[model samples]
Target: MSTEKPRPTFQMDGHDVPFDEGQSILAAALAAGRYVPYLCYHPEFQPHGSCKVCTVKINGRTHASCTTPAHEGDVVESNVDELNDMRKGLVQFLFTEGNHFCPSCEASGNCTLQAVGYDLGMTSAHYSPLFPDRPLDASHPEVLLDFNRCILCELCVRASALVDKKSVFSLAGRGIQKHLVVNAESGKLADTELSVDDKAMSVCPVGVILRKRRGFQVPIGERKYDEHPIREVAVQKQKGE
Candidate 1:
């Protein structure tokens, strides 16, 4: 008799998905070759569940798949039209809330938000543009901060505090006023201990944190998302490709 136990499985969109112990629904699904549209959920960090883009129905009620634990025999619905429409709306809101003029943005092809927007078939913003007049932070000689392009995912904040061991970034205000701020008395990246090699510098899913004078080094069309859709790239990355 074998001593090893069988893996727990869940029904995702009618397909059987086997998950390892302590895996979130999002993590397990990606590992099982299932693609779920998400923005704030990164496999590298603990599940934030801030962005509800991965919202899926479990049994009857909805939950954020990124934070939801996988259980045996749980019926999860993710790839349905209803859920996809809701995800699309969330992406649209993100687009309109920020000045994501994709053509003019440096993170156009490489941006996870833009890739998720495409995966969800977001044809238009649908809502009127907020166009919040946010200031750009160019005080850092090695990095550039474009506040207008930020979706407030807080990847940088978590990365700085956890991985890099430096609390370089943080969130301020609440709700509509909630935004990213550097942990500096002068409120600037240059004043903080942030470096180009820090984990926080590369964790931004958008163009908010970028290296100065390093634009288009790989060329626009040759970027990561440019070669493969984020759906494929994200899952492949999780699979250690």
Candidate 2:
């Protein structure tokens, strides 16, 4: 058997946090019960750094928490109100760009995007809707894609690449016209290896990607997001780590 030394632990925001060698700043903070707001981040997937929502002030400068590795004596502060507002504004921009009709959505109560909106106190979307008449693909028989609800977070695309071990989803087109494209040639999700068990379905923050059978399985009141703020959940998850 091979022997290897374990990574050291450090203090962050008054809590002892362990960093396993290449563990990220965000991962370390989560282990220490510090609530850092983020989107486009999943523990089981690779860090893409596409979404700047998780940016934090590290040593008096902002850094993408997901991409920054945890080191000894690093000062990470996540409680700044300005940072909070920035995240809120990012969420607002995402909301205005998409057709996030909470009351009519199947993933309304349990969606992380919705929870973020509530945390930001965004009662209504102020910007004009893009109203892109994108196609809804229910060809997979187990998943549905409502492109109008997409936020281009790349979670679904990354999940298919990293977690599911299949590069099924990709971003087609460019700029304001970019969108989640399924497989090659055919736009149908069923044509690819994307299964119901894929992480892409679970990683989508908005109702853009949804499960065909699992929608509304849990009542609105019983959903994990309905009872607590996203910050509380992040803190609890951090503590559990």
Clashing pairs in 1: none
Compared with the true structure, all predictions reach lDDT values of 0.90, 0.78
My TM-score estimates for the predictions, one after another, are 0.97, 0.86
Q: Ten consecutive residues with minimal summed lDDT in candidate 1? A: 1-10
Error of 1 at 121 (Å): 0.7
Separately for all candidates shown, the number of backbone clashes (residues 3 or more apart, or on different chains) is: 0, 0
Kindly report which residue stretches of model 2 are placed more than 4 angstroms away from their true locations once superposed: 1-18, 238-241
> For residues 13-105, what per-residue lDDT tens digits would candidate 1 score against the true structure?
889999877789999999988999998887889899998999999997899999999999999999999999999998888888888878878
TM-score of model 2 vs. true structure: 0.86
Scored by TM-score, the top model is 1
